[model samples]
Target: MEQHNRFWRIALLSLPLGVFGLFVIWPLFSSFYYSFTDWNGFDANYSYVGFDNFAKIATDRLFLQAAVNTTIWMIAAIVLPTALGLMLALLLDSRVAGARVFKSIFYLPICLSAVIVGQIWTWIYQPDWGLLNTVITQVTGEKFKYAWLAKPDTALWSVIVAWSWQQTGLSMVIYLAGLTAIPGDLLEVCEIEGASPWQRFRRVVLPLLAPSTVVVVALSVINSLKGFDILYIMTGGGPFNSSDTLAMHMYNESFKKYLMGYGSAISVVLFLIALAIIGLYFRQLRKVDRIYG
Candidate 1:
């Protein structure tokens, strides 16, 4: 009977394992192999020119700029949304009236498609008749107009804000779940001990939210690195490549410029960076888990 059960279990897993190997693993290896070649991404004839593409990356000004921008995006994306989400989660976790309505309103942005969010924000940032500028002008009685998505200095940050708005809901939901996991009795005990709200949160609540923090941090980092759709639609990496990310750079090289080999190299670099961050995060999570346990 054990043998029969094992056989069925293996059989049940085989199809998914095979599919993953074929669709995911194989393509990943193929991209790595092609990164060494000078394929234009379409033609059948190509030659291996290894490390040449990678060498060019070192001197490529646009790539360098994209790398910096990506770093900024990664940082902003993780910090702002996570902070705002935690705050919102705490607010909604209370017995405040209309908490459910506020939650639904906050979460609505996350449910909208990225393209839609980009378009909506694009309208809001319009210099001549945008929602924001118009509101400012009306309230202040002074002509206030600035192209938020056009200037190099403001473009990247503007997009980051829009992306954060969409992402904050996800963080809030994750934190809400984490808050639910905390025992209510523990909070009551803290109250009974005359601990201030801040002390209760810092001493008891924060320590217990480690698992949720891990999830939120990991997801925020991954999503930030993968940012593309909003950037593509809103900025298109415009105003002298100011808002371009590593992923956008890869796409332009591979698809737009047809420098498949170079693009593959960029993708490899991105993958490695993401892998390193994930490794460090997992290590940190282990430490947190041990301390909290």
Candidate 2:
């Protein structure tokens, strides 16, 4: 009976492992294999070109531009949403009146799909009649009309603004959870010692929230790296690929341009980059834990 139970347990675990191997693991290795080829995604005339795709990606001017834009997006995604979220969390956690209502209002954006948010922001960014420009002109009493997402200079930043709008709510919720987990006794002790509000927060609240901060930062970094739907809907990597993120670039190369091999190479690079970021995040997290242990 014990052997029978052990056999059943092995069988149950093997099912998921087998499925993952078939679906996820197989595709990852296959993508690496295809990255070295010149396949057009379909056809019997495919040939392995031996690192030519990676070589091309290394030298491609447009790919380099996309990398820079992605980096900017990553930074903005990390900084802006985090700052806004922390602010909101601190305010709401103070037990202010109508705080729940404000929290709900802020979090509503997170429930909306990224594509829907992109469409709404697209209308807001319209040149002459858009809400943003219209409000700017009204407030400043000067005609200031420009295509927000069309210009190369403002394209990436515009998308980042929209992305941050949705992401801030998520960050706020995470920080709120962290804030609530903090021991009330610690705050009371700080107050008893006549510690200033800023000092208490800086010394007690922030340090205790390290785990939550690590999770939020890691999630934000990964999401920023994989940003696609919003960019796809808003700019379609348009205006001379000004808003092209790595994910969008990969999609365009694979489906639109029919360079499946090169697209696979791009995907591989993205995967490696994500892995490196995650690895670094864990390393820092371990160091922080040691210092605070």
Candidate 3:
């Protein structure tokens, strides 16, 4: 009976495993292989370039801009969502009317696909009659028609705002779970001891939330790296490539420009960056565990 179950288990896993290998693992290896070649993504003929692509990366001004934009993207993505979520979690976790309904409303975005979220925000940001502009016009008593997505200066920030809106709920839910795990008795003690709200939050509540913060930050990091689809839909790295992140740049180079080899090199760099960040995060997590545990 045990052998029969084991065979069934392997059989059940085999298809998904095979599929994963074919799609994900194969593409990853292909990217690495092509990174060292001058393959234009078509034509059987190509040459081994051996770090030539990497050399070009050093002097490519657009690459430098993309790198800078990526850094800003990651930083803003991590900070905005995490901070706003924590605030919302704190607000909604308290005894307020319709808290449950509010939580559900906030979390609705996470259930929607990225495409849907992108579309919703795109409409909200429309220049002429969009919700945001309309509100601004009403408040300022002027006809506001500034194109949020088309303007180079504001495009990246506008998308960042939309991203924060979608991601904040996930962080909030995680933080709420963390808050619940804190002992009510400890909080009661603080209150009885006449500890101010800020003091209790700083000296007790915040430290207890360390685990949740770690998880939220890590998710923000990974999600920010993969936050290309919405940008693609919204701006396509437009207005002189001001909003072009590393991933967007990679896509443009690989597919649009048909510079597959150079794009592969960018992908490799991005992969290394993501790997290093995750590694460092896990290392710090271990240290935190040792100290806290």
Give the runs in model 1 whose Cα sits over 4 Å from its true position: 1-6
Task: Write candidate 1's Cα lDDT for 80-162 as tens digits.
Answer: 99999999998899869998899999999987988999999999999999999999999999999999999999999999999
Against the hidden true structure, what lDDT does model 2 obtain? 0.91
Give lDDT tens digits, candidate 2, residues 67-177. 998899888877988889988999999999999999999999999999999999999999989999999999999998989999988888898999999999999999999
Query: Global lDDT for candidate 1?
Result: 0.92
The number of clashing residue pairs in each candidate reads 0, 0, 0
Candidate 3 per-residue lDDT over residues 102-139, each given as its tens digit: 99998899998877888999999999899999999999
Instruction: Give the least accurate 10-residue stretch of model 3, judged by summed lDDT.
Output: 284-293
Residue 3 CA displacement from its true place in model 1, Å:
4.6
TM-score, cand. 3 vs. native: 0.93
Q: What is the lDDT of residue 20 in candidate 3?
A: 100
Clashing pairs in 1: none
Clashing pairs in 2: none
